[model samples]
Target: MELKKLLEQQSAEAWEKYIPSLSIDCVIFSFYENALHVLTVNMKDQNLWGLPGGYVQKDENVDDAAMRILKDRTGTENIYLQQFYTFGNLKRSESAFEAYDDSIWNKQRFVSIGYYALAEHSQVKLRIDQYSNAVEWKLIETLPEFMMDHRAIFDKALLTLREQLNNHPIGYNLLPEKFTMPELQKLYEAILGKKLNRGNFYRKILRYDILIKLDESRKGGAHKAPDLYSFDLTKYNEALKEGLKGNW
Candidate 1:
């Protein structure tokens, strides 16, 4: 009973001194027309684009706060969100807070954690808040002048996604449930920002043995329709554990 009382006392003490300053930033990524896209919110007063982020509430977990921020900013939920890294550099810029008339930056130092979500472009319905002038999708290659160190944060998230693609099934997050072989190949080319030999790419993907060939093919008139395929998550998980090589 004495040990239980001590445990209760420590828990109470810990709660009393906790100051909630943790924030979460979501780097919502999507693919469209052979290009990677990132969601950006335009600040009305600063005329700068920034990632959708929010402070974690005292009652909510870090992952919960990230999902809330993504839903509130992009009207997206039930999407795949992965915690990539945390940015706690003391010298990180808080210039965006200075842009406001209120002394928002004078509060306690904030240590923001970054999370990324991948979803189809057609699934997101962006809703800009009062403080934000607009919310729109910006091509990864052509990001606007942003505020704070958001550009660096975004770059790190993209790098993590690329690294994950080598060993994990990242293509499912970027493409539709049923996609053509050429479409799948192009998606990788876009993410890697390079051209891949069509024949070799096909061979490599086939060797993985994680794709389910569907009977349907792309309906077109110009040329032969490419066969449709879908990822087998069951097989993918097993193969992913073995680590995939992207030599092709």
Candidate 2:
């Protein structure tokens, strides 16, 4: 069946199968080349950009709904998700959904649950969802004007990411399996939106004892190679459970 027909049929009966006033928005943060980027879509409105989002099914768990929407929109699954915040302000959904029927939407105020995720930038395969085009990552600092409260959502996500990096070992998911100390430090700096003294950062991270240094180094660079490190996944997993912060 054509996607348009399917959408119309679903909209006709959406109230029966989906929650009318609740939706989900995802802040997919991608870190690469020592910078933080966010996944934004044109949403058929070339002038306005927003986070990838969708309505929730009536029978769906919010977490499951987030995973479904992420996979459907990005063609990737099993990415880790963290529920960040819920935006319930009356004006949150003021922007118009031009492609959607007014009768199906605009019937009620919407409350959006925001989720943040971290995954290697290369693993993401962008796919066109129902209303997005030219989907791509935009630097967090240089994002275009957001359509709704998406900029607010991204800000909350970034703050959560910084907290998680400090309290959990989740940041490894955003880095290569084996990485140089500089690369790891840069990732944290990018997410934190600040620079740290190289020596202080290195010393602080090393005390965590969560990295397994390897003799191998980053190759093919003109500069002297820095020692490579692989995450001690065993310790990292334990840290995720017990927490790792302020021990330095």
Each model's lDDT = 0.78, 0.80
Q: Which tens-of-lDDT digit does each residue in 112-183 have in candidate 1?
A: 899989989888888967667789899988999877778888989988887888676678878889888888
* Candidate that scores best on lDDT: 2
Assess every candidate by TM-score: 0.85, 0.89
Look at candidate 2 and tell me the lDDT of residue 201.
89
